[model samples]
Target: MAALFLTLLLLSSAAQSAERTLVFAAASMKDAVEAMARAYRERTGNPVVVSVASSGALARQIEAGAPADLFIAANPDWMDYLEDRKLIDVESRTNIAGNTLVVVTGDGAIAPPVDPEPLLRSGRFAMGDPAHVPAGVYTAQALDQLGLWEDLRPMAAFGENVRVAMALAARGDVAFAIVYGSDAELSEDVAVAYIFPPETHAPIVYPAALTANAHEDARDFYAFLRAQAADGALGPYGFTKPAAGSGS
Candidate 1:
């Protein structure tokens, strides 16, 4: 009888030790982060949960005391916001990857000029809400740089996020949509119109950090994400390594 009791206690302890849950990332990281989480679980035997949404929205949630263990934002701005508020562990914060902004058109549509100027003159464009989606903010920066923001403003359809912007373009509801290069690759219904010149806007940096509410196992998972082993895992999903001396 004592042996049975001891076995049960040991089993319970093991179960507790193995159990792990974390809000693993941002909406833009849906594809890559999901794959990484699955691989992480299989290799480490720890479960990770992901929350996908606009980086700004996720930041607001974390600030509101959401139980997030880790945050992977599509841009450094939101991560900076969290750090400013002391909601993230400073040592654990790092810019892990970069992405490009691309313009997309629905199936059968004529590709717009590689430069955004012609597209603004041609027809309406779809983009995420600049107030919340980093992709949209980047798009705005690019447009402003091209001196077409005023002209394009009249024809803009704002999506809640990049996915929605892609959807709008995919369904032929808009002439063009600005989104991440990864998003363009995922949707066969949409064709790439143009890739914004990297010089036109600020570099897009995806930063990850350990949240203050993270468990020990969650922190371990976050560290694993930055390891060299994870580099290739992030690339196929349209991420590039951070430039030298770029991340904070």
Candidate 2:
């Protein structure tokens, strides 16, 4: 009888493991994704495991065989990297959401249309590392378009990801930071001081796809993302739904 009970326990454990879906997502999507995961769980009774970090970092991990079933990137570049390497299903890729860049301050007191020049002159400015981070790249482009890059680059403080940059400003480590509007919305310590003109940079879009070796079960979760996004689950978090019929 004891042997039969042990056998039943192991079978149950295996069944549970089989129902788990692993997702690798950019850090900025953390809050929205977690909420989606919970809703999915309530509806499907399947467990979802989420790993959030910089898009660059997560891409490297997936390349190194981290076993992610799906990936949601903050920018199209990282998704392109994986797709180019045949690490993701090209046909499965789709634009999921959109975001805007904003200059933020620690005290939520700074007003809109801020002049970053004077702000950066006396203190450090925080942003993601432009070498690979999307937010940093967008910030660089906007600053260059406004001809502020040459002057502001000197006082720039780099973070591994947008959230880290936002944290720097939120913690008073820097005078200001540029982060996704969604990120600033979630942080009480920070306020949007200025919104970067979309014309100054490439469109900010989030793309999601199944990994090359994605478990068949992961497909359901992938579909859930589309369904939830369509339902405007990300709206309250300050993310815009992808334009209808937009491809990755």
Candidate 3:
């Protein structure tokens, strides 16, 4: 009886300690989400597990059945990809934030009207894979909008994610990278060369949603972010509040 009681107590302790919410967020939101996780734990004692990566990669992971509690994508398209497959709770989905694109260099600010073609000819320009990564998708669209796509294609160095692309510039492997305004602040080595006009491509938006099988606590964490954003929790990290009618 004593041995059985001890075993039961251990199991109970394990179960209590195992309660955590898993969130898959876009790479660009890493700093903000990490900050939120710390605050959430202090307030509710419910730990949050945040996985950061490119929206495309995170969506693919979800499609392949990774056990994600929440999905906060850097763009709506990836969240749409999951929602179409019934992987997400559509009613819970909302645009949580917004960002803009920028071109930056590690060594110094490159003057704008930012003619990228000649710059690309002499140096490899970094971006997330324009085919899949949201930042890259936006970059490509903007380049096309500016008539720079066809000419600059050959000089592209694609990273699997936005941060990876920025790292190329951060590490001096590439001098320039087109990245989110939020993410550029992460690398001391890179400086903003040009801010892409919002009209250059589709507006950058971040949408968050619960998985269809999300933990009940997942909803709580989601709500906390919304509340805190209103209270300025997101401001320090360069996140902008979602505009009205843009909440998805």
Candidate 4:
């Protein structure tokens, strides 16, 4: 009877150890992070929960006292906002990767304009709402650099987020939409019209942090995300590791 009781206690402890939850991530990271979370759970025997939305919205939610074990943002600005509010563990904050912005059109759509300027002057374009989505800010900057912001502004259809912008382009509602290279890669239904030159806008860095309210298991998962072995996990999702000393 003593041996049986000890075995039951071990099993119970294992079950308890397998439970964990996380929240706060950008909308664009939903697909990749969800897959990563599933893999992490299987490997570590711990479950993970995620909340996805625009980084700006997530930041507002956290500032309003939402419970989040972790936060991953598409831009540094929002992460800095959280740090300033003392909502995240400063030591756990780091820029994990970067991504490119691209202009994409529906597959087999009319060939893209050689110069985006002509397209902007003639037809509708789609982009995320810059006030709320990181991708939109990047797109705005790119257009500004090209001297096309004012001209393109009139034809722009602003989606709630990058995903919505991509959907608009895929549906042929707009000639093209600005979205992350990774997002364009996810759907063969969309064909990339052009890659916004790196010099055209600020680099899009994805920074992650452990929320101050996180449990030990959540912190462990956060650490796992920063491990070198996790590079492969990030690559397929259109992320490239940031240079050492770059995130600071």
Top-scoring candidate (TM-score): 1
Q: In model 3, state the lDDT of residue 230.
A: 72
Model 3 deviation from the true structure expressed as Cα RMSD, one decimal place:
2.5
Compose the digit string of candidate 2's lDDT tens values, residues 162-217.
99999999999998899999998888999888888788888889999999998867
Question: Against the unseen true structure, what C-alpha lDDT does each candidate score?
Answer: 0.83, 0.88, 0.86, 0.83
Question: Which wins on lDDT, candidate 3 or candidate 4?
Answer: 3
Ranking by lDDT: 2, 3, 4, 1
TM-score of 4: 0.89
Q: In candidate 4, what are the lDDT values of residues 1-248, reduced to their tens digit? A: 99999999999989778756776888888877888788878888788998898999998899998888899988888999999989999998888777889888885645656686765565798998899789999999999999999878888998877888999989989888899988887887898878888889888888899888888888888777777325667888777766455574
Off by over 4 Å in 1: 1-8, 108-114, 228-230
Assess the local accuracy of residue 83 in candidate 4 as a C-alpha lDDT between 0 and 100: 93
Order of quality (TM-score)? 1, 2, 3, 4
Tens digits of per-residue lDDT, candidate 1, 81-200, equal 999999999898888888888888885546556555766567888998999899989999999998988778888998878999889988888887899988876677888878899888
Error of 3 at 10 (Å): 9.7
Q: State which candidate has the highest lDDT.
A: 2
Backbone clash pairs for candidate 3 read none
Candidate 2 error regions (>4 Å) = 1-18, 114-116, 120-122, 243-246
| Residue 70 local lDDT, model 3 | 92
Residue 234 alpha-carbon offset, candidate 1, angstroms: 1.2
Q: Could you estimate the TM-score for every candidate?
A: 0.92, 0.91, 0.90, 0.89
Give the per-residue Cα lDDT of candidate 3 at 187: 65
